[model samples]
Target: MTEGRPLRADARRNRERVLAAAREAFAAEGISVPLDEIARRAGVGPGTVYRHFPTKEALFHAAIVDNIERLTDYARELATAADPVHAFFGFLDHWVAEGAVKRDLAEAIGSDHALELSSPVKGMLDSIETLLHRAQRSGGVRPDIDLDDLLRALKGTFLVTHIPTITDAQRRRTFAIVFDGLRVR
Candidate 1:
């Protein structure tokens, strides 16, 4: 997984499998998912995972970055959609739905750490701001809200849904309330 260096075909496949497994595992179970578990999920040996990612931090960061990059890209794409109101609310719904169960995603962007405020995260924030501004201008979202407000609301939604005992019905109800608060009417 070295930069600019090509891996052998089998090695590359193994790496890809490991990364996919890591992403899915982290998304579903958080960073605490064991390397061995990831290996089993990938159908590779634990040594293969270690070979590609020497440390859990390395694998975790890579998976988190990949997920964040994907989310940012999706938001940027939606920024140009014909309906900003739909795009903005749909994106919020997507995050609330996925982030509720994605512990690693919640932890990655939910923090105030140095890395959390840098390029990757900033890119996502910019996209969200674009959608938020467009929606506000269209009178679909409350004009009083800012990026920080929306982000806080998103974080709160993620946290509340992460409660182990929260039912799916309750989670949906919670997000319905939060989303209603964000809407203009």
Candidate 2:
């Protein structure tokens, strides 16, 4: 039996299970969910969890990145939307949802946004930049605004969800305020 090949299938299944469990746990209880609980939810031992992800933080990072890639794909579709305003709002809604889910990605990834986002980030940025350019051409968003600032603001909004006892409605209201603020006067 090939040494590496023998473990490949089992390893892939374990990783997938761990990620699914971690996603549910994080969504239900935020980032503070215990690793042991995640392992139990996955029907795996704690040692297996460790073998896959050494720390809760690392597992969280993986989940966050996975979610980001999916969102970025959605953003790609939005970029081609016929309505520029709708496209912008689509991107906005995506950021808000991802923020609501994992408030710590911005902190772990950093302001530069180079981390956590690999090729998918680049693809999304290209789409976003093109869309922003089109919107600017149509006199939608402010011409003076930079995409980097928008990204930082979006990340900031996500970070706000981590605050204790903030309701989802409150987060939406805050996002509305920021969204209106970003619009061209």
Candidate 3:
């Protein structure tokens, strides 16, 4: 019932508020935060939140999709940078830093239902791959590294080092070590 038609101005405002509140709540409290609490935080009723998102998983998926879209846009913009290798690793560092607070959404990205979401996840991946190829062609990155290899290393590092207990300095150190391994020998 909530699909197909365009939302009225007030309804659109409420939906944005719900998403912002949900992102904050999920970041601070994990994905287990209650819908009613999110509604309260958003200054809207629970029914309003449900009307827009349908279910908690749907809301979480939407949030992840939003994050991915932002990252994709960032990568696209970085593609035009003068130094291809700097742009590529800069995007990776930016992503890892942002993931410190938004780590809760990472699991949802890898979830079975992620593909069903509306976000352009594939486009984001393609952007990264393009960056990697550019860096490889310029001899700034190792010849053997591919998109999958970079993704695995980056995701693995973030998953292991982005914990609440880890200091920002520690995260930076870990990222530096990881990036060192990716650089051309």
Best by lDDT: 1
For each of the candidates, the C-alpha root-mean-square deviation to the true structure, in angstroms, is 3.0, 3.7, 2.8
Which segments of model 2 are wrong by more than 4 Å?
1-11, 28-37, 54-58, 101-114
Which stretches in model 3 have alpha-carbon errors above 4 Å? 8-10, 29-34, 104-112, 115-119
For residue 79, what is the lDDT in candidate 3? 87
**Tens digit of per-residue lDDT, candidate 1, span 113-132:** 55467678788888889999
Tens-digit lDDT track of model 3 for 21-128: 998887766577899999999999999999998889888777667787888999999988899999989988788777777775455443455443444777778888
Return the TM-score for candidate 1, rounded to 2 decimals. 0.77
How many clashes does the backbone of model 1 have?
Answer: 0
Worst lDDT run of 10 residues, candidate 2, spans: 107-116
Kindly give the stretch of ten consecutive residues in candidate 1 with the minimal lDDT sum: 107-116
Count of residue pairs whose backbone atoms collide, per candidate: 0, 0, 0
lDDT of 1 at 75: 93
